[model samples]
Target chain A: MLLPYLLLGAILFVLGLIGFVTRRNLIIMFLCTEMMFQGIILNLVAFGRYPLKGAPTFDGQVFALFLIAVAAAEAALALALVVLLYRYQGTLDANAYRMLKDE
Target chain B: MPPHPISLSALLPELILLVAGCAVLLLGVATTAHRRRLAPWVTLLALVTAVVVVLFEVLITGRATRPPAAGSGLFYGSLATFVRIAALELGVLLVLVNWSAGREEERGEFLALLLFALTGLLLVAPADNLWLLFLAVELVSIPTYVLVVLSRSNAAALEAGTKYFYLGALSAAVFAYGLSFLYGVSGTASLAATTRAVVLALRDPNSLQGGLAMVGIVLSLGGLLFKIAAVPLHFYVADVYQGASSPVAGLLGFVPKLAGLIAIFKIIALTGFWDTENRAVYWLLWLLAVASMTVGNVLALRQTNIKRLLAYSGVAHAGYMLVGVLAGPLAGKALATDGVSILGNGPAAVLFYIVIYGLANLGAFAVLGLLRTRGGPCETLRDVAGLLRREPGLALLLALAMFTLMGLPPTPGFWGKFALFGSALTASRLTGDTWLIVLVIIAVLNSALAAAYYLRVIAAVLLYENDQPAYAAPREAQSIGALLCGFLILIFTFYPSGLMRAGQHATRELSEPRATAARTESPVASAVDPPFASP
Candidate 1:
């Protein structure tokens, strides 16, 4: 019963990882991380419904709530950094900000 | 257990830091003019108070002296006490380093963020559950992202901040996903409960439950490796270090790495993975240790920018510490030979190494922060030419720091590396693992290779001559701090016993839970009861 949900969560996580690696836009990369969080949240909820023991408990769901809070806080910081980067560099492209790299 | 009643007194240091952070932020809003003058002092006061509290808890009053409630779940163990004290001491040093840097207007915010980060670090060392661990990791990292960007308003700082943020966010996501899987399999978030559940699941290695848990371990560890600045996740380090100011870079270099390493140690101990059928995790760590050392040193040899060079060197140091991690105690007693057990020394060696590394690395950055030109900080090797002739005191300090980093004798780094590599050799001999022996050989060779670059920096300061105008004289406070760090490094070499004793004490405390968990892992009890359930 839980197999399909677990599989879906795994797929979403992989997709998010791929998107994060392939995307160059600062905001897009952050969104991909959010996608990854959502996938994990899905798994947490599913696991809460089908716990290993006799009765399903809310521990996994509670953990998912905490994850959401942390992700939201991270998003706020990410957007602020992105805005600051754009203000300084005049672009959101990750490739444009390569001044610190070795020549 | 009904979720043991939380004890505020056991959490005094973190509570004090949190209040201080808020007070500094509020003071900034209330008294704008005096905010700069008041902030660092307030932060210092908070750090001193926290240190005193930790000292009382660990040394004066003692762990057993605390109330019963104070010794459970979130607040237990001398390991937490030791790590918290270390983090507080490092926080105190970082605040001192940043005392004169940054604009006056942002000083309060800077101190506040630093305090918040220290609070997070202190919380992390004592976190008993996966949820607290996740929160503490984010709390430590998010402020650092702000600190990096706020170090300067330039495009470079912004770029570094963006890169750090994106990668950091991704790593957090990966960690959360991995945690979900673990929670799914174990049906609990408490370390003890999860450890119990995973042990039973892994008894049957080919089961679906065991497979999922293995994935959980790898993914979560991958997330943590980013924080430790290991290979494949270390690409951002050089750029970030170069972009951030020297003081902030110094904090970033050590604090997160310390927290992450301790967290990893705790998880590994709890899971008892070393005793399980899953030997693949051991090899994965072995590969990372070797790769980080080789890659960090090889690339560092070509770097001209001093900051970038030290960044790579920091990465290499992480590799060395990972060797200590690899040498951690395995579960079974099969490897024990002749009653000489070397298995448990890894954590202690790592603890000792972090203190030495923190002093040397932070001291080096302090000197770099001191030698700023009109444009900005003097970063390249050429920029420091003839420094010995111009500023003998600063030059001597930098040279000492460089030599210590190279693990030369009569410095703490020598003893630090000696203990770490010794532990690795001991583990290899005890386990009769040929691979660990090879890893130790690579580590020794990497240490020798690393000396070349560190020596080149020393030579630039001592031997080369440049007609460039004399560098600006450093502020007295900053110079004194760096000098103090240098003095400690030199002094500790002759008297390493004190530090080693502390390390042993902390490591013993940290390993107790695992030892107990292993003894109590009866299949019937674990299968019948959900250990984490509230009564």
Candidate 2:
């Protein structure tokens, strides 16, 4: 049962990683990162249910709680930033802003 | 000695910061009817308050204790306190430097994030358990992800924030993987117990768990090294600095790097490999220090953008400090002829160097923040050509910043480098290694190399023909802020004793000699081990 949850989390995380990397839309990319964070939560909760050695520990659950809080906070600010960028540049395409000239 | 609960008093500074940060966020919404300019000032007030409370706590409490957790309590002591003071002071200075930019948008979110980040760093210095360290590092880092994107008016700002978040998450994952390896090796995450296990592994190179633990330590360093913008992980730093405003760039570069370096110091110190017998730890840090210095300087040499150059320069500085940490751990014990205090001396030098470096870096960033054009902050070398004619005072401030950064005479930076180099030199002498001395020479030479670019800016301001470059106009706030920062740089040069004394006091707690210094000995040293376990 725990293994199934872990597998689900792994798939979600991979999908989110792909979306974040391949997508051009800044907001969608950010959403994908949040999706990846959810995957982390899933893994943490599953681990909380079934400890590696014996009895379940609260460490995994506490960590998961922090992750959820952080992710929520992150999404709020990230979305706000995306909105601000669109206002400034009139677009959400991540590729258009390549002004940082690398030498 | 038995287990005792972790003290809440030890966590007061973080509590104060969190409460203030939440207040700023709440006021961000509640004060909609107030003028937008009021929010940043309020945030600034909160930061100042946080600093005062931290100062009071450190000065009044004298010492705060953390209970020994199974995995994280090994990094506790004055070393952590001193580092927190240095890092938090940098955060406070950042608020002052970037006030001109933060005020322009009427956004207090930056202030809240800045306070929150400092809170995280404060917690990081004292984290004794690996799990605690993990949580604390995120506490420091997650807010920064928000800070990067809080000022959303510009395309560059948003792009920088996005890239930073992506990279930050990757680093965090890498860190977790390393931590997992550490947990597997020691069967416990506590640094005290883990050190014993690691020593066993080191003695027998064939040990799978030891090899895995080492890889984990290295991988954990990857995430931290990224924050400090060190070699192999520094690619993101230049881009992020170029895209962010000068103030954000300054905070992004300085605060996190200080936190990372302190964490690195704790990690190195706890591993028990700094002793001469620990050949592996010495070799690793020696290689890391040299690589960081050479790469940062060489890469910085080619940069035209001032921000990019500074970013690379920061990486180089981290390398130099790592050398000090290596020296402190590897040779301090062996060199203790007649109980001559080499242990205190090495770590003391590192702490002092951090304070001096923080001051000088903050001063430089303050001036750079002032040099912003109406469009945004200027990034190019050519943008500062005629600055001397219009703002001689600001030019002088930049000159002082450059001289200090170059580690030139009479400045705190000079003494700071002298401390670091002197410790490394002494360590090499005691350890019978010319290679460490060679690393010092490379560091000094790189300082000279650093002088070229720092002086380039000075020359551009003072000696270059006064042809007005684009966006060379100075705002009133920039002038005032530069003047204040200039005074600070100058003060640091003349009155270095006060800061040095503070740093010295901060390291006084961990300077004891251990009878059981060998790995086969007891897990925790008897010198300052408390009787209670943390609940």
Which number leads on DockQ? Answer: 1
lDDT of 2 by residue, A1-103 (tens): 5568767876877788788779988778877877777776676666555533334445455556766776776677667767766777798898877767576
Q: What ranges in model 2 sit over 4 Å off?
A: A1-96, B1-4, B31-37, B57-76, B103-106, B330-346, B372-376, B469-481, B504-535
lDDT of each: 0.79, 0.67
lDDT of 1 by residue, B1-535 (tens): 2324556777888999999999988876665576558877899899999898878766666562244341134645667777887888878888888887556677777789888988888878767667778888888998898888888767788778878888898888887887787777787666667787777766676888888777787788888888889997899999999999887888888788987897788667555755552577788889999999999999899999999999999889999999988887442133333423334477777888988888888888888888865556788998888888878887898898888889997788888888788777776776677887898899999999999999999999999988872375548767777777777777788888677767766766554566434322332222334433432
- Candidate 1 docks at the CAPRI level of medium
lDDT of 2 by residue, B371-402 (tens): 65446566677776777777676667777877
Fnat for every candidate: 0.62, 0.14
What is the overall TM-score of model 1 with all chains considered together? 0.93
Model 1 chain B poorest ten-residue lDDT run: B519-528
DockQ metric, candidate 1: 0.55
Cα deviation of A102, candidate 1, in Å = 0.6
